[model samples]
Target: LIWAAIHRIESGLNDFESQDIIVGTLGLLFGLIIANLIGLAFARLPIIGAYGPIVFSIVFGYAGMSIAIRKKSEIIALAGNLRLGKSGKDHGSKHKDMEFSGKLLDTSAIIDGRIAEICSTGFLEGPLLVPVFVLEELQLIADSSDLLKRNKGRRGLDILKQMQEDNYIEVRIINDDFDDVQGVDSKLVRLGRKINAKVVTNDYNLNKVAALQGVAVLNINDLANALKPARIPGEHMNVLIVKAGKEENQGVAYLDDGTMIVVEDGQKYIGSTVPVTVTSVLQTSAGRMIFVKIANE
Candidate 1:
């Protein structure tokens, strides 16, 4: 203890040459000195002087011992939990395919609502993965003050619960978290790459980013477009003009399938259902847009 004190003072004297080392060494020495000084001052007091050091030492000794034991136990518990998780993963591989055909569901997919229908039909094969972070985000939305956001969050939870009950669907919650990631979309892409699973999302930007990274994406919008009924020019169909379109004299209607139908000169037919002939169809990466002209009523 005396040797340590001398060494610390020597380092402090040569502070400029070894500033950080001196500061750290001196800080320890200063604490020890202050403690010893306090003990000495207590000893100088009347009747308590004889038992001062003993009582103080005993009190601090037990506290230090308890803290040491708690820290050691925590380390052991952490190691054991890690070992158990690894063992479960090893054992679980025997039943499920080691090469997971799992689908990593993104935030948009959960909110889109069509995934529930698709899952009901058994099209989405393999386990559906919902990251722990994504679940937390959904919970936040559910608790949000905004009515629409709260409803969306509640709907997501409902869908999750429905999936859990369906024997055809296997839902897996991945506890992986990327602290460096800000948005859920980026994290979804990162997770998809790590797990070698396809991403199911309705987010257009996420779809594009995943594709650039060579991560397989199962976009709901793409699926919807593919399943949408093909409409040829001159085909007659009745549609409800819900609103006016971007162009003059054009109105917009949506099929039960949610495909937008732009009816020319159907602006006047807004808020009414009318028969229309398909004039043209525009298919974009976004989705299919149909142009039509209301048939002379």
Candidate 2:
């Protein structure tokens, strides 16, 4: 009987996430605090009084655990707001929820086209929620008078269709437009909060804005950059300098992945495959740049 109980407890623990554990523990502590306060007042009740503290402890502890686990998302968000208040790091958006939470796709992410590929690769799991407002925006862009916007809009729509056709993928087109929200970006942020989903976007401005509002964001560009090969100082490679860089005595080459390498004083070997040694690497929201000099230099 003892071993079976232990095994059951172990199984229950295995199903809980780390966040759940932390929140549960905190809830238990608060519950114990409240229980002791009440027990102190009731301790003079003779027989019941003798066991008041013990009884209160168990009752409060269980209540706390049940309430905390059920309201985990709200409690977590409240914690985030408190931390943000103290740190003052951001405009103080609420912290991101669990990684496995649903992703709310913005127009930019949909139009970028890479999201479809990323989804197909199985790297991004969970239902992809496309808000009706975002779909309407896509439709507007697709029907635009400008040829460029029209093509991009149509491409985004086609990508959505492609994703929907895949049997294993889950795509949800939700109708949750916050009419009070002034812009699509704002609506996306609002919807993200309402649904506890992360706003998936590649637009830098939207990323910043959504973050400022405490809405979670998953930038496709950020993922692409992280997956690129790391280029550290002193790494050596050979490349044919393709063209002159914007600065003097700077020639440019590119990695097969499209990362730019600026070679110092390498104009002389524009067409020649010369060995080079990396001096430094610069990464930014835009992309990565590697600075190198001729291997012999």
Candidate 3:
């Protein structure tokens, strides 16, 4: 209205674009700017100015009330959603009762690095979850000063790339993060608990922590343990001892499965395949350690 009134006043003059007209236009614009600022200032005052405060309070108050009401309603809805009968927690509990086939791979598992071969073997079933934090850790390792760590990180990335390319494995980069958790291992445990998924890792400390939390963990070492070929005591096998063990006349040979075989009185059999009888097998948390004795050449 102010602009219209100003325009009307200007229109009454014949010379619209002359110096006099330009001066009037500038004066009107400056008046509008000053008036708007004054109106804003008056609107902020407790009980001053005409109409500005009352109008502003009514408009803003109604808007704020509507927003507050809506927020209250949303909070009620969310509370309802959190109930036992209708909660996401109940749904998750139901899922927990069922067999979860999915696996969450940790950064260490990927870097300790047998996952690619394990996946290639076609035995690792279900989707593989690589959390966003795990990826960040891998990237950090790839940027590390240690050559071994850098190589491991690059290898992990390469394995993921190959898995994606081959379509032999399913991959999901989960974006969930636990702000309260300080480390990726803890976040992984929380994620596994939340989703009722199994964690695949090769870290000994992580395995212990997961067990303590009662979360299911598929330790690569344990998998390797279960996958090792069963060797019975007194069973005969051929091995080539490469080095002497710490004990006297104890020769050490490694099997195809990376199982260390300790042979008694077989130091002369070093670098040569010789028949040996398995005397005993020690099954530890990590894997099997076979103690053998040379029975014949």
Candidate 4:
């Protein structure tokens, strides 16, 4: 029984790994120290001294431990700040560069057609850098045999033209191209690193790759999802059932901004507009999805 208990404890510790265990142990130690100090203050009381100190110790110790464990991230950050202060060196310039850095527009963001609107809102500052390689990729898509690809490419070009003409934001065409990097996404990452700029893209793959390469990314899809009005259960909205969904008695529709809605028992209502009560909302990396049911039923 003793060996089994030890094995269980070891397994539980393993679930937390190295940093978590260290933080938890430190938290417990700090809690115990605080409890001891508080207990000492109550030790002189005549009537309450006997049990008061003991009770206070236990309560204070547990409270401190729980607080420290819950706020481990904040504690770690505070420790980091203290260590940085002790080093006595200013690193403000490094952070300042990142703060005012230009935004590198990826082909995916341009084609998404929301960046222009976002910029027009005056939220995004600094010059919008459009790499020459991205333009080439857009041209290739525009000349593609696929009709969908051609139209998307044309739309991207139109968006770019509109941004250039808009007086609110500056759009600069960067001539920098990497011969070593074969993929456009890779090139964007490299350019972002070189210029200390953030890559603006809606492509999930590109977003992941840029992050892996230590390049900052501003995903347009993420922005769109964040800007969407919050919907809660029981809220009713009118939606046209466009097509059938994967599940039985389900139909799919889309909002004006392309947020997908899955309606229950809506397959029969296709081609007609009907009221739907929001059952739930699922926000994913790609976009937001609303699960609904027919309002009447």
Candidate 5:
């Protein structure tokens, strides 16, 4: 337990940037001083007088830490105003210089494997950061007892290896990791914030968490969804009716891209490819569905 506590302390120290620590320390000190002064007034209150200073110190100290960390750039800028172009630097820190810092790759993104292709096309420019901790997570998955997970891990490793070998894509191995952050997702988010890089991932929960924490995330699944072409009514295509639809006498087929094709009164056409003319297209929460009839029918 003592060793565990020490490890946690070490991680916390390692995770915090020097600037943040310095600013946060200053804020905490000022907060504590203000709290003690306020506590002196509360000391006159009969019931909780003795504990007022302690309560105020804890509350203000925490508030100070939160505000300092959240507005560290502002504070730094204010300090710079004593000598430099403070406001411009503050604005540009978030917008200008950070834009091209890099894209941090999560383990899931590596496993999905489209990133390498995307990188090859010369569209995704910036350093492709494959963090050491993420690699460790991938290694752990590769060694998992479950065969499916192990296979995925191995595949991810292969994809990463291939990306590294590619000349066009600069796959940078990032050694910076947060030991204090328990999960890989949390660490990834933390690292993204620290480096001011966009996280490249497909995990929905990670996307939400990163957004909530004010870290930009490039979700591959969202990208794929956006890139899916819009299907309109009256489009004709060939599809194979693989099974009966849930509706009466309806045949179910799928396009090569996996969009559902519902064939009207064509249940008997199962196990065969058929030319279908699109009657209508419906967008549902589940996915896109194309309703069609047999060609020329």
Candidate 6:
């Protein structure tokens, strides 16, 4: 019966991939070594010395094997590092050379379309991966009955095509998907975890969710906000008053890049272009606002 049970256990282990077995074996060996060292330290304890090593060996060996199986990738990476050290290669430099392992583009970011311009600037590095599911989502939007969503979806497709044509960057449409996962954002987070990549998105909720899951997110909106021209009081610029603001005699204009400018006592100039002096600039989490008045008013 004992021999039959042992054979069954061996057969069950065959279900695990080779890497898992190797990592588990290494962990068990490491645990045994640690247990032996601890046991030797307790050798002077007259009562505990006799049984301590055997108990520690069994407990720690099982614990280590379980942990190693669960964290096989980490153990593999650690082993790779040791190999690189022995070969005298600077493994740290390899990581430094990469801006990111990979960048997975989400639907919102693709629709926002600034990612194409950002990539064209040669600032973003590494492969840009667009999952098949994200493409399907875009197609769904393109086929939507709503005009706005259709246009946005088509625009995203165009941006993606442009990025693919750029020779300086690598854009890959990945087929890897998780049907078991529900939302696109959740699938994106899962894919990022699997590939150890960062998610590029313009979604606030996805950003928060990915952060909670310890996934890196490159928010395109945050990038745009960061890249906006910095303005201060006394700066003068031309703006066209597009509409009236909340305050009396206030006109609202927008910069070419969409920074809102509130003009003081200039409601009369609605629908007209005029020069305005920056009175103050308020930087908020939502966006940047410039308060201004007609120059020389």
Off-target runs (Cα >4 Å) in candidate 5 are 1-100, 226-229, 245-250, 262-268, 277-297
User: Cα RMSD (Å) per model?
Assistant: 16.9, 13.2, 16.4, 23.8, 11.2, 11.6
Q: In order, what lDDT does every prediction score? A: 0.77, 0.84, 0.76, 0.84, 0.82, 0.84
lDDT of 2: 0.84
Number of the predicted model whose TM-score against the real structure is largest = 2
Which lDDT value does model 2 have at 125?
79
Structural similarity to truth (TM-score) of each candidate? 0.63, 0.65, 0.64, 0.62, 0.59, 0.61
Q: With candidate 6 superimposed using the best TM-score fit, by how many Å does residue 36's alpha carbon deviate from the native?
A: 35
lDDT of 5 by residue, 160-202 (tens): 8888788677776755766677999999888777656799998
lDDT of 5 at 108: 90
**Per-residue lDDT over 200-225 for candidate 1, one digit per residue giving the tens place of the 0 to 100 score:** 88888888999999899898988889
User: Residue 82: error of model 1 in Å?
Assistant: 23
Candidate 4 residue-wise lDDT, 1-297, digit = tens = 999999999988887636556777787778778877877888888877788767776777677766666555445545655655555457543432233346889998999898999899999986788988999999999999999999999999999999888867978676678898899999999887765678999999999988999888999889879988899999999999999999998999999888899999999999999999999999976789999999999
Alpha-carbon shift of residue 118 in model 4 (angstroms): 2.2
